[model samples]
Target chain A: MATTIIETGGLTRSYGDICALKPLDLQVPEGEWLSVMGHSGSGKSTLMNLVGGLDRPSAGSLMVGGEDLLALSEDGLARFRREFVGIIFQQHHLVPYLTAVENVMLAQYFHSVPDEAEARSALERVGLGHRLKNRPGELSGGEQQRVCIARAIINSPKLLLGDEPTGNLDHKSTVMIMELLKELRAEERFTVVMVTHNQEVAAWGDRTIYLDDGVLVREERTNS
Target chain B: MLFRILKNSFLKRPKAVLLIFLSITMGAAVATAFLGISGEISHKMALELRSYGANILLEPSAVEGGFLREEDLPKIKTVFWKYNITGFTPYLFSIAEFSAGGKKERGVVSGTWFAKQLEVPGEDSSIQGIKGIAPWWEVQGRWPEDAAEAIIGAALAKRLNVVAGGDVTTIVRGRSQQFRIVGVVTTGGYEEEQLFAPLVTVQSLLQLPGKVSRVLVSALTVPMDDFGKKDPATMSKDEYEKWYCTAYVTSVAKNVEEVMAGSRAKPIWQIASAEGALLKKLNSVMLLLTVLALGASATAVSTSLMASMAERSPEIALMKAVGADRFQISAIFVGETLLISMAGGVVGYLLGDQLAEVISRTVFSSTIVSPLWLFPTAIISALSVAIAGSVVPLRRALLIEPVRVLKG
Candidate 1:
């Protein structure tokens, strides 16, 4: 009975007349690894978008670590995103122009004054020490995702959201990224919400939730 | 950090930055050269007019009363502006005939202090009294060194078939004096149809020693308005001389009258004032050219920055999404423009100076010296163009929807 880190009640989202996410209720305890599994358009990515402050819920109360996210202004939300939450996308959205170290430094720039030395160490922690000066186009897919992971956690956010963090990786690279994430979570103790379609990936988390047609159909707990 | 960012960004896109830089440079160069040469020309023209003898002239109070005496010169030099007094050359004109190269022509025989012989204290030939007064006079030969020698004007010399080392005779009051022609002067005025000799020699030969009809005085005077040229009869005596001697045209005339006995004086201002009006118009045209040039520069900058902004939307969205406010984003873009402008301004100023020299030399066949203040003026103009042109594009950059763009 750990304290709950995220609480959502009656959360719903709509685009025009079509509902993208229906009302739902969920609670996740602190320091948990939760995996969301579903097909494309299953509302899993939409739910992640709402939780990550990228989109607003049409009707809901979202309390993340005791803060009411719905009441924050745009800039306030940006500050919250910088200081409290970090997100990784499937596309690896790292700026192509900056090197791996500089990409990590950008997260610090948003949170505070960028510290190059700290960013360098962050890249090294992600096993990108040898590719600090390599641009995204120059790095392999796995290395680019590693740099994105480095950027996400450079600010030491309390929450990490991954939308297919290794969707484009090879089988070995996928295992490498998951192991890296599991190790980082063990040390940092930040809660993670990962969206994936692979059951093997879902097994790594403490609990797995399944969604279909924007509705939660089932929930499974794997860890004792 | 902003400068570093500016430098890095500029280096990243040299082609785009160079386009804006070159355009701003052209704008600054045009502004600096036109305004610089315009100001200098106005000042130089003013100086040239100042040396055109008295702005106000004086003769005997009554035409037949009498002439001024040589003793009056000391009093003229001792006026309130005794120090501001430049120099005075006296003249006594007599209608006479002269012969040169076996040809005789009727010419005005003028008595000048030295006519053409120029020498100062340290020099061998005298530099006074007429040679110093008429500096713009182009001379073909030397001025007369002896009392019996004279210089003929180019027009009169051609009419009389005369050259240097020739002789001419002048008849006045039933007495004729033979004098050698020493020099021919061209003043581009009525002075070109006259003969010049030593004042003492002319006075004695005419049997009117120590007498001068009038005097031409060159003084440094301030510019005057139309009201400053009001008729003297309409002014009170206190108002008269005050208006006459304050280094202005009216002041010069009043000062000359105060010193010379039974004589009146006038300034050369009427001619200068007319020239001033024309010059003021020319300067306005130059100013119009500068404004139009800057406007064109701004337009060019705007076009190029807009093109760059199109290519940089993704970067702008990236920065915006990363929590950069509008001001910070603008700093990066405008800072880039300003840095390029600084380099452009320095290059443009040097280019424009040479351009002005070439244009002036080719058109007017006269050398134009570009002044120093043009450099900073060029830089400021370039900076302003860069700032002005980037404003709208920067606003466009700020308006980019970070979420929409990044999501795309």
Candidate 2:
């Protein structure tokens, strides 16, 4: 009996007169890898932002882990994002001044007391044990992305969100990152909601949904 | 972790941190310098005012060579306002030819008390002398104690080639006395041309026993008001008593005049009024300059921090996206500014202490004691500038929308 980790009913977000995400109903079960495929200007990023508690919806209800995110204040949403969700950005946004280990510790610090040992082991788990002291600028594109992945999971969040996480990587790096994500998800048993435009990346998920013109146009189940 | 982030950020952006540090240091330094100097200046001015503090000058009222009797001097301490008069010294001036080492100079020889102790019956004995009144007169040696001992003024010593421990001959009305010069006094006034001797010596030399030409009195006096300026002779009996009782310089002079026979007492208005007016103006100017300097530094701090905040928006946004609440974000930025300000304050205090010394030496031609209170003043002011300057920047940091900032 799989429980629904994220449930949205008619969740809508709009900027002025332009609606970025129309009223759409969606449900993501626990431990499921859900991929959202959309072209540019499509509401993929907007949906991800709302689910990550970084954006407020124009209308509708969003419940993540049985807590109504719509009812949470900005500070409450921040706590929710830190305690319940982990996000990986397309640009691999790590504090440029902080080293890889420090960046991983940053997440742990916000969630609770920072544990350097836990942060170190998280980086090591992501194959960045030797590069703990290297800053983002000193690392390669793939290495920077790996550091971001370590930071995102340092708190062991129940839900992971990736907004085109591998969009800037080469094919080998992209494949390697996806495999790492798959292994981490299997071990951690956390639900993943990824937004991408690539079919190959969508195939790595258990399910895929296509959004066009602020509307969900299709849903497809891939390999279990 | 937050400290680590802030440390790294500060190290990475040395220009911005240094800009803030410099502004805070400059503000604290100016504040400390102005405040230190103002306090020291007031203290020095008070001492200078005290040195030239002869508020009451008593002279013989008669046009003839009549003098105030020495017997009447003890009556000054028994007057109705006796305690108000801090000290008084009598002077008998005579023109005499001073000859020493074959050099001759005609100079005014003044006979005055030199730390003489006097007793009034049924009252506490007190010291009444030039030492109590003219503290600014720099003496190179010692005051005259013997009847045949004298202190020659600096200019008079130069004219007569007299030094301390030398013998000088003084001839007055063809009656001459040989005296040992014990000290050379530098008064920076007309007194620098006179020779000072004990009152008994001058009395015997001038053949005027138990007589004094004038007296200079130092008293603790309040600033004169309209009531204090009224003529005591013209006032009613009640008004006159009121005028006589007050410690105003004019009233104190009147009290002295009433106790001394045939003496006309007047207040030295130039020094009394100048002290008040100058101190008020100087304090106001210092306060205004301190406020302006603090405001200018706060603005500089704000401008520099704002520029840095704009540059670090992405870092701020990333922190927010990673779950940093408003308090956490504010703590990082405010903590950094506070640490910089604390360092600035200590450095500013040291620099400002030296600056105050330079200013006092150059302007007042004197050294000042740096008050211990100014250290905390410097630090608190630095803290004020940091806190004031960071308000806007912290607000901007908190208002940063992570979605918009991290979109790229």
Candidate 3:
């Protein structure tokens, strides 16, 4: 009887002559973790971008948290992205000039007003208290990704989107990032839509949807 | 938060920020220097032209047996446009036989004030003479100082075979007077064909006391426009009043004529018209140069900012991807540019002041004091160039697609 937080009916996206995502009908209940699995060029990232409001669907309806994204302006979509969705890119795209704490505050700055103490606390939660003043160049790959996570979760979003959040990390660092996400999600009670190619990483989600050549192929449920 | 980001960005990317800053600074410096010196250049040029000759000529109304009163010369300093009358000198010419060094010749003998100081009621004492009005006259020796001393013209001295330290006897209708030749003057004009002596001595020798043939007046006047060229006799009451009040050469001449009885004052058009035309052209050239320099500097700033924007695309994309709206993105970039421009404005103003001084000293052999408003003008111009330069790059930055950029 859980309420559905995301509902997409025949959602589609195309770039010029090529369709990145076919008509996709999907729904995710509140607080559920949904994983999208696909091979290279299989439109997994396209779905994540559309759901995160970073890209628009060419056709069909997309409703997230009772808001019709198709009807919103570009600025409205930006507001929705800041208030409703937080995205963690696989590249760990942090502003190299800003420190770890300042990077987290950047998110709060866009959301409302920057709170330095809260940004510090968010970094501390991500286990980067000692590296608060260190810029992205001074941090390791895993540590930078942790700063990305801290920045993502600082605004308290309702839906968190991860595009292979651990694609560049080794097995140990990947496991640590997943464990941290699991703990944060348990406490925050936010929905997660993670896109990945690794079967082991997909196993961390409550359910997995596989895509092949821009079409949905199969589904799997995890008993975690 | 904006300030923090701007600080860190500038600290981290000194090369790009400095490039844009330098462009704005150069533009602002050129603008400030040109604008600062433009007004001074015209004034200096006018003063230089004034040395060519006097612009106003005063003479008796009648051509025959006509004379201007010598006592009326002091009233020239108390006219409505008195301050505009920089200097004036009176001349009394009489044909006489000049004899010096055992040689004799017939030439014109001219009496004029040679740097005599005049004090009028309710007016400060002022030096008014040929020395002030005709500065181009080159003298081989000193000017005459006493009733017995005279400065003979080069031609007249050559005709009489006389030099400085010689004595000359001038005979007018058999009334002869002796004068010590103190100086020999070369004027390249009719003055070189006449002998110059103190006015009082000439008046006494000619038995024509307190009488002058002509007066040359020099005045500072604005360039004549159509309104200034209008005849006061044909104008309405208000228009005539306006024309009379303006410091045009014609108006200033009229002011002098009204003061001197039975005298006609007219502008020496050869000098006044030439000065007006030259001043007008010089001002136009300065204005054109200022606009061209500003345009060139704007191009430099735009090119530099565009290049920096290209290099910073990834950072802008990252900001956009992190939920920075258009206003936020604009704020960051605009804030950075404004901070750089303000610093550039201050630096450019200082540099431009020095530049104006150098130009003034080199061209006019004088110094210039920039007006107080030039400071704010320079800063505003810098800001304008910065904003103008940021337009295209800011638009490009806003058009950046985060998905494409971050995917790289």
User: What TM-scores does chain A show, candidate by candidate in order?
Assistant: 0.98, 0.99, 0.99
Candidate 1 lDDT by residue in tens digits, B1-408: 354456557767889988998999999889887877787666555556556644444466676456778767656556776545556678888888776667878878888685434333432442336666667788788878889988889999888877888888887777889988888888999988999888888998878889887777766555565657777689898876667555555666676677677787766656546555656677778899998999899999999999999888877766655555566677778888888899988888888888888766775567777666777788898898888898888888877765456551
Model 1, range A1-224, lDDT digits (tens) per residue?
79998899999988888887888899989899999999988888888877777667899898887878899776666677777777777778876657788778777876788888998898888898999988789999999999988888988888898888888889899999999999899989999999999888888899999999889999999862
Number of the predicted model whose DockQ against the real structure is largest: 3
Q: Chain B, TM-score, each prediction?
A: 0.68, 0.58, 0.86
lDDT of 3 by residue, B142-248 (tens): 99889889999999999888999999999999898899999999999988889899899999889989999999999988889999999899999999999999989
Worst lDDT run of 10 residues, candidate 3 chain A, spans A72-81
Who is ahead in TM-score, 1 or 2? 2
- For candidate 3, give the DockQ: 0.60
lDDT of 2 at B328: 88
Candidate 3 docking band = medium
The list of candidate 3 runs beyond 4 A from truth reads A1-4, B60-66, B79-84, B93-110, B120-126, B138-198, B201-208, B225-247, B254-258, B262-264
Docking level of model 1: incorrect
CAPRI grade of model 2 = medium
Least well predicted 10-residue stretch by lDDT in candidate 1 chain B: B118-127
Worst 10 residues of 1 chain A by lDDT: A73-82
Tell me the lDDT of model 2 at A148. 93
Give per-residue lDDT, candidate 1, residue B402: 54
